[model samples]
Target: MTFASWQFAVFAAIVFGVYYLPPVRPFQVQLLVAASLFFYGYGQPELLPLLGIAVGGTYLFLVLALRDRRWLPVGIIFNLALLAFFKYKFLFFDPQAPALVDIAAIDFLLKLPLPIGISFFVFHNISLLVDLTRDKKAPLPSPTDVFLYIIFFPQLVAGPITRAGLFLPQIEPKRFSDVQLVEAAKWILIGFFFKLYVANNLNEMTSHMDFPFYETLQTQDRWLLVILYGYQIYADFFGYSAIAIGLGLLFGYRLPINFDLPYISASFSEFWTRWHISLSTWLRTYLYIPLGGNRCGKFRTYLNLIIVMGLGGLWHGVGPSYLIWGVMHGLLLAVERPFLKKFEGIKSAGFRALRIAAVFFCVTMLWIFFKLPNFDHALAYLAGMFRPSTNPNPTKLYYDLALLYSLPVILQHLHLNSFFERRLAAWEPYVYGALAALAYLEAGPATAFIYFQF
Candidate 1:
């Protein structure tokens, strides 16, 4: 279930309630595993067996890899294959066909719906195998612990993509007294506020940016919507990550922090470091470093950057737009690399501000590819942004509403929240309470999180 849903609210509450009971303390790991299974299956029970095979198979491989290093690559490939099959199988075969190969098992596997978190959990599996097997001295972890690590309800879906080395060790009996109630409440509240009041509301305006509808938007409106979409996507994904982290804290497991004011970043490389920190970290550690990161020559480093970024883009989905989005980002990084040192030497505030604006403008413009996944549509929209609209009728966007909804994201990137926290220390709790009220009151029409498709 989605984090914004009332169903999830009830589910989280019930799970939280039963989690800390005196009798349940010893079985905390098992409890969380069961709860996670239920949470995942709550929406798609049919996929539970796939989930089982993934985790169980990963665990089996982990054990074998610990004994024989050769098996590690095999295990990693196995997980990658699962990701490839579920994520890209549609490119090769049509699931809607009544019958294809005449093999019931293969057909059943092909026709099954894409599992919601396959991308995330497969990474978890790879990380688990790679991290644990790197040190052959490490003992084999129990199957249940591995299961919990792979499918913990909070991050089982869209993730901060926690690493095996970071998360596996934290699996232990959690104490109620140790729960960070106030901290957790703040995260959950801010998450809900951003998702509801900001992202969902902005979605109403940005929805006009889609296909035939965007063709009806005026040129200026198209530009306005692209910037608004940048804000909306950040709020949506950041909101989900925040909720995941807060829930992790409530259960005494700490997920990685995902975003750190990415829009304000002055460089594309810095932006990657700040935005989706976990995923970037995973790519660096697992993919980049192994491919001889910057340790290789300058030319190799540039090639590595393109390769990683291209694969990272493909990881999101199968499409030319996604590839272009990623490759363009890689190009930005490559182009900026030689000048970054000189740019960093500058001390003027105006220079810094200009750099930030330039980076943000480039990033925002690229998001059009994400909004319009069809390559031609993305080009058409980009082309429209540069020319006057010829359409007889244009969609009227409410600029006031767009500004109101996007203000939070703007203020947040500026770090204004820190100012209020320090100056209004005594009023913090009450301020949160008001925001909670405002979020509920202003919440817009529900939309599935943008990252859910990945």
Candidate 2:
């Protein structure tokens, strides 16, 4: 269930209530593992076995890999196979067809809907195998611990992908007194505010950016919607990550921080470092370094960058638009590399501001590909951004509403919100209370978290 829903609220409350009882302390990991299974199964019961096989099989492979380092590559390949089969198989075969593979079991497997968290859990599996195996002397973890690590409910679906090295050692019986209630409250409150009051409201305005609907927008409105979408996506994802982090705190498990002020980044590489920090870190550690990273010659490094980014793009989906989006990002990173030191040498605020604007503009524009997955539609939307509107009737947008809803993200990125928060330190509780009220009262039409599609 969605974090924003009443059902989830009830579910979380029930789980939380039983989670910290004196009697339940010893069974914390087992309780959480069961709760996580229930949480995943609630929405897609049919995929429960798939989830089991994924975790169970990964655990089995982990056992083998630990005993024989030679099996490490085999374990990694097994997880990759699962990811590739679910993520890219549709590109080659249509499950909708009547009789492509007449075998009932194989057809059923093909027809099975993509599990919601396959991408994320698969990554967790790989991390488990790699991180644990690397030590060589680390003791084998219990099956229950492995299950909890892979399927931890907070970061399971759309993740601030916690690495195995970072997350595994944190497993222990937690005390109620140790809960960071204030910090958790702050995270949860800010997350809900962003998701409901900011992202959801902006989603209404940016809905016009969808494929056919975008064709009716005025020229300037196209650009405007792109900026709003950039904000909305940030709010949506940051909100989810924040909530996940906060929930992890409640459970005494700390997930990684997923975002910084990414929009203020003056370079594409800096932007990646700030945005989706966990995923970028994952790619850098597991993929880029393994591929030789920048240790090789410049040409090889550039090729490695492109390859990693292209695969990163394909990881989101098998769409051409995703590939183009990723490749373009890679190109930007490569193009900026040689000039980075020179750019850093400039100390002027105006020049820095200009660079930030340029980076933000490019990043926002690239989001067009994400907004419209169809290559032609993405190209059409980009084309419209530079041309005059030709539609006989253009969709109207409320500029006042747009500014009001987007003010938080803007102020946040500028660090103005921090200034105000410090200035009104004594009124902190009241300000957050007001935000909570406004989030509930002003929340817009509900939409699924965007990254859930992955």
Candidate 2 — which residues are off by over 4 angstroms? none
- Per-residue CA lDDT of candidate 1, range 131-204, in tens? 99886666788999999999999999999898887888898888999999989988889999999989999999
Query: How many clashes in each structure?
Result: 0, 0
What is each predicted model's overall lDDT from 0 to 1?
A: 0.93, 0.92
Across residues 257-354, which tens digit of lDDT does each residue of candidate 2 receive?
Answer: 99999999999999999999989999998999999999999998999999999889989998999998999999999999999999999999999999
Cα miss at 414, model 2 (Å)? 0.7
Q: TM-score for all predictions? A: 0.99, 0.98
Question: For model 1, what is the alpha-carbon lDDT of residue 182?
Answer: 86
